[model samples]
Target: MTWNCRGVGSKKFERGLRFLIQERNPDVIGLLETRVNFARAGEIFQKLGFKTWVAVPGMGFSGGIWVAWRDEVGCFVEKENAQYVHLRFSGQGQKDWLATIAYVCPRDKEKQHFWDDMAQFAQITQEPWVLLGDLNDIMAENEKKGGAPCNSRRCELFAERVSNCNLLDLGASGNRFTWKGPLIPGYERVYERLDRGLCNPSWRCLFQNAVVKNLTRLSCSDHNPLLLCSNDSGYGFGPRPFRFEAMWLMHSEFDAMLKGCWKGEGGLKNRLMNLQPNLLQWNKEVFQHIQNRKRKLLARIDGIQRKISNFNRPSWALINLEADLQKELEEVLHQEEVLWYQKSRGQWVNDGDRNTKFYHIRTVSRRRRNKIVMLRDVNGDWVEDQVALRQMAKDFYVDLYSEFHEETVQEKSLFDNCTVSFPSLQTEELCSMNREITKEEIKDAIFSIGAFKAPGEDGFPAVFFQRKWHIVGEDVVKYVFHLWQDLEDLKEINNTLLVLIPKVDRPDSLKQMRPLDYVM
Candidate 1:
C-alpha cells in the first residue's frame, strides 16, 4: 500500500497508518511526505511490525519517504534521495523486482530534477520495477477536477519520463482523485490524481493478474492509499494460451523452426495440433533467452553512454564498444517494434517512421482501456472480483444466444402462387463456383491478406505463412486442396474466436459491445 501520509510524526497520522495496516495487511508499505527523521521513522516502523524498513529523512519537517516490508519479503535499499527511495526485492522461487517510492517536490524547478533522476534510475535498473507514490502532478486535465488546468509543459515532461522508462500506469480503482485541496468561499477546490502506480512491461507480465486500487479516504489526510493486489489464484484453469509475436519472425531460427514442425503426418487439423508442442518448446528455449540477452545489451549500452558523457577523453576501446553495442541494439529494437506494432493493430502508423515509441504507447493504452475493472450486472450490482467478472460475461453471452423456446414457422408451397423474378444460375455457372482450388490459388489467397492482421485462435498471422512461403507453401496448398475436395473438411477448420469491441466510450452492458469473428 502507498500513501502520502502528510506527516507521520503526528499522533493522528500514526493512528491512521495503524488503521490502514490492520485493514489492508499489505506485505509492503510505502509512505510519502513522512515528515520525520530516520530514528523516529525506524521506531514507528518497528512498532508497526515491519521487520525491514528504509527512509529518506525529511529536511526540517518538509518531505520524507519510507518503504517497509514484511520479514518474508527479502529486499534491500539500492538507492535513496530527498525525493525517493529505491529497493531491490527478491523472494525465494520468485522473480526479483525493484520498487521505488517517491515524493516529488511541488515546485516546478525541483520537479524537473525529479524527472531527470527517474530517467537515470530507469536506465540502470535491470529488474521488473514498480514506481509509485505522490508524483505531485497529473498527466491530463481530466485528472484534476476543480483545480486550475494542468500545465501542458509539466504533463509533457512527465509523459516523456514515463515513456523513456517504458512504464504503463497500472490504472486505479475507487476515487478518481487521490488528493484534495482546501475549499475557499469564492474559488473552486482543487482535486487531482497525484498518487498512482506505474510499472514496466516486465513487471506487468510477471504479475499479469495484479491491480492497483485507490481505496476511499477514511482519515483526515488528503491523499487516499493505493493498494496493489495480485489475484493469481482466480486465473482460469488451463495451460497458458499460445500467442504468436511478430518479433519471433525476426529471429534467424524462426523459419527453420516452422519448417521442422510442419512435416508431421495426418490431416491439417492434427498437424497443427502436433506443431503446437514443438512451437511452445522453441519459444521457451529461443525467445526467452534472446530477451535476457537484449536486456543485458541495453544495460551495457547505457553504462557506456554514461561513461562517454562524463569523460572528455574517452578511451578508443570504449568508443568502439559503444558503436558495436549500438548496432546490435538497433536490430533488437526493430524486432521489439514489430512485436508491439502487431499487438497495436493500428493502421495510421507505418513502418520506417521510427515510431516504435508511439506504437508502444498505443498498444499499452489499448490494453489498459480494454481491461474490465468493474461491471454492473443485470441486477444493477457492481462486480469487482475477477472471477465474478468472467462469469458474468460468460452468462451474458450464453443468455444472449441461447434459445429458451422454439418458434413455429408456417410452411408454404413454392409453386402455389410464386412468379419467377430472375433466372436461376445455369449448371455450368453453378459448377464453376465449386471448381477445385489450385496450389497457385492458395498462394494468391494467403498473399492477398494483410500480413500484420490479427491472428486467429491458431496463433499464426498471415505474415508467418507469407514470409516462409517456400518452406510451408506445399503443406498449405495440400490442406486447401483437401478442403476443396471434401466440403466436410471445412467444418474442421471453421472454429473462430469472438472478440468484443466497445461501441461506446464506457460500455456497461453487452448491447454496447460489437463482436467480431476471428476465423483460424
Candidate 2:
C-alpha cells in the first residue's frame, strides 16, 4: 500500500504525486527528497490526510526524507541512524503489526557512512519491516534498461545486509527498469533501476497480492513514480452504475419539487437515497426498451416520409381524365401562365401574344398541372396536417424523456454500497482520542491506522477536528467554550437542543443568556 518514491526534489513532480495521492486517497504515503521544510511538509501531508514526519538537519540538496500516515496510525521515527521510520497498527480483536520505510544511501565510498548506519537500524528493529526507497544500486544488469555492469560493491553490500537480516527483495514484475534520464538529442534513453522495496517474511504475506506499476513520468523527474495497490483484487472490476449529471438533472424546475419533498433538504445523502430506488427500477425494466422503440419508430417514420416524397408521380388515369377535368385544368393552367408572364417579362399577354410568351406559358402550365394532378390522384396532401405533426412531436419528446430520466436497479445498488464494512479502521472511540493528539501518540498509532484498510466511506474527514462539537456526552459544547477561549479551527458551525423543556416553572435566570451567549 506504500512505497518510497524518490521525488528527486522536483516541485512539479511532487505536485503531480500529491495529486495522485489525493485522487487515490491512500492511507499512508512514504516520500523522499520532498525538498520542503519540515513544517511545510507537515502541512502538505496533513491536507492529504496523513500525519507527516520529516528528517531533520535540513540537508538542503544533499538528501532528506518524509513519512506520512493517517492521523490514527501509530508510528515511531528513529532519526539517530539511517533515518528509519517504524510504524505499528493495532485493531480490536486482531494481532498488531509493524512496517518501516527509509532511504539508505548507496554503499559507495562517498555515502558509506549512511549505509553503515542502516546496519544498526536493522539490528535494533529485530522485527518484521517493509523497507522501501531509492538505494542507488542495481541488483542485476537485467533489472536496468540500457544498463551496463552492476555496481558490484554497492549491490553486494545491500544484498548481504538485507539477506543477513532475513529480508526479501520483492522484485517488481512486468517492468525491467524504474528510473530514466531526460531525453538527449542523439543518445538513447538513459535508465537506472535504483528504487526498490524489501520486506521481511511477515510483510511479504501482506504484499503477496500487491502490485507496483511504473507510472508515467509526471513532471521532469527522471524516475517514474510507482503505484502500489494492495487489497485491490476486486478493486478494478464491478457493475458500474449509470451516472447522471445531478446538477443538470436537479435544475431550477426540479428545485421546488425537491424542496417540497421531505428527503431533499436533509443533505446530499438523503436526496440520493430518495432518487435511487425509482432510478433503479426504471433502468432495470424500461430504459433499454424505450431506447430500442425510439430507434425503430424513428427509422419507420423516416421511411414512410421518404416514400411519400419520392413516389409523387402523376398516373396515366389522371392524364386520361384531363379532358373531363378541362375546367379544373384550364383554371390551374391560366394561373401558371400569369405567373410565368409576370416573372419573365412583367407582362400578362400569355399564349395569345408573342411566340416566345406562348412557349413559356405551355411549359409552366404542364409542370403546374402535372403536380396538381399527381396530388389529386396518387399522393396529393397540401395542408399541413397539424394533428399528425403534433403526434410525432409528442412521441419524440416522450421517447427522449424515457431515455434520459430512467434509472436502473444495478446502478442504485452500486451507490447503496451493498458490500461494505463499517466503523472504519480506527473505531469511533480511538478516533475521538486521536483528535488533537500528541506527537508521541501520532507516531505510535501510525501503522494501525495507516495499513488498516477500509473503503473511503468508513473514514471520517479531518474537517471534523476543524470545529468542536458533541460526539459522546451532553453539555460538551459548553465545555469546549469554557476550555479554549480562542479555538479558531475548532469553531462551532451549528448547535441545536436535542430536547426542549417546558419553561414556565423554571427560574427567570435559566432563561437569560450567560456563558451560553457566545455559543448561540
Candidate 3:
C-alpha cells in the first residue's frame, strides 16, 4: 500500500496507520509526504509493529518518503532520494522484482527531472519492474475533473515518459480520482487521478493477476490509499474459454489437419463441435509454444548467417538453408502477430500491420479494465466473495429474463394491434425470401460475416469456413438445405454463450451492464 498522508505526525494519522496495518496486513507499505524527519518516521512505524523500516529525511516539513515491510516481502533499498525510493523486493515464492515508489514534486521543472530520472532508470533496469506513487500529475486531461484546465504539454510529457519506459498503467478500481484539492469559492473541490501503478511489459507478464485498487482516502488527507495485490486472489472462474484462433490459419499443417478432422458422422454443427477437441489437441502439439519456436528459429538463422559470413566458401546448401529458415521465421512472426491482434480486438490492424507489442498492451489493459474484483448486491452491500459474486450475477440474469417473459405474456396482445408504418415487402420480395436457399447464397452469407467474429457454441469462426470452403463447402451447403427443409434443425446452430459487458466504468451492479450473445 502507498499513501501520501500530508503529514504523519498526528495521532489520527497514526490511528489510521494502525487500522490499515491490522486490516490488510500488507507485506510492505510506502508513506509519501510524511512531512516528518527520518527519526520521527522511524519512531512511528517501529512502534506500529512494522518488523523493519527505512526512510529518506524530510525536506523541512513538506517532503519525506518511508518504506516499511514485514518478512513476507523482503525490501532492500537499492536507491533512494527525496523524490523516490527504488527497492528490490520479493515475496509469495516469486522471483525478485523491482519497485520504484515515488513522491514527485508538483512543480513542472521538478516533475520533468523526475521523468528524466525515470527514463534513465528504465534504460538500466531489465528485471520485472513496477513504478508506483502519487505521481502528482495526470496522464491525460480527462483524469482531472474540476481542476484548472490541465496543460496539454505537461500531459504529453508524462505519457511520453511512460512510453519511453515501456510501462503500461496497471489501471485502478474503486476511486478513479485519487486526489482532491481545497475547495474553490465558485467551484467544488478539484479532483484528479494523480496516484497510480505503472509496470513494464515484463512485470505485467510476471504478475498477470496483479491489481492496484484505489481505496478511499483517509480523512486526514486528500490522496487515496493504493492497495497492490501482486498475486492471484484465487478467484479465477475456470479454464479459459476456447475460441477459433486466426493464427492457426497461418500454420502450414493447419489445412491438412482440418481435412483429416473434418470428416465425421454428424451434420455441420455436431461435426464442428467434434472438431474442437481435435483442434485443441493439434494446437497443443503444433503451435503451443509459438514464441519459443520463433526464438529458436531466429537463433538458427543467426548461426547460419554467422557461418556464411565467417566462411567465404560457405556451401550453396548453407545459403539455401538460411533462406528457408528466414521464410519459416517470417511465418511464425506473422502467426504471433495474428494471435496478438485477435486478443487485442483491434479493428485498425490489417494483414501486413505488425504492431505486435501495441496490440499486446491493449489486450492486457482491456483485461485489467474489464476484470470484476467485486460487486454490489441489490441491497447495496459490497460483495467480495468470488463464488458468491458469480452466483449473484447468475441469479440476476435468471430473474431478469423470467420477469421479462412474464411481462411479455401479460402484454402480448399490445403488439397484435400495432400497425406497421414502414414500407412492407412486395410480393416479389416475399417470393424471394421463400425461394430455396442455394449453395452460392450460403457461401455469400458465410463470407459476409466478419472473419474473426464471435462464433456459436461450435467454435468455428467465419474464417474457418471461408478459407476451407473447398473442403467444408459441400457439407455446409447441404446443412443449409436441410435447415431450409425443417427450420427446427436450427436448435444445434442456436446455442449461445451469454456474456455480460459493463456499461460504465467500475460497475458494481449487474443491472449496470448489458449482455452479448456469443453463439456457440
**What TM-score does each of the candidates earn?**
0.64, 0.40, 0.86
Candidate 3 lDDT, 275-298, residue by residue in tens: 888889998898778889988998
Please state every model's RMSD to the true fold in angstroms: 9.5, 36.8, 4.1
Better of 2 and 3 by lDDT: 3
Q: Candidate 1's residue-wise lDDT over 130-208, tens digit each?
A: 8888888888766777746568887777778789887888887556789988775666998888998899877766666
Candidate No. with top TM-score: 3
Best by lDDT: 3
Q: Model 3, 332: alpha-carbon shift in Å?
A: 2.2
- Tell how far residue 352 is off in model 3, in angstroms: 6.4
Give lDDT per model, in order. 0.78, 0.46, 0.82
Q: For model 3, give the 10-residue run with minimal summed lDDT.
A: 403-412
Off by over 4 Å in 3: 72-74, 90-96, 124-126, 146-165, 233-237, 286-288, 298-313, 317-319, 348-354, 404-431
The model with the greater TM-score, 1 or 2, is 1
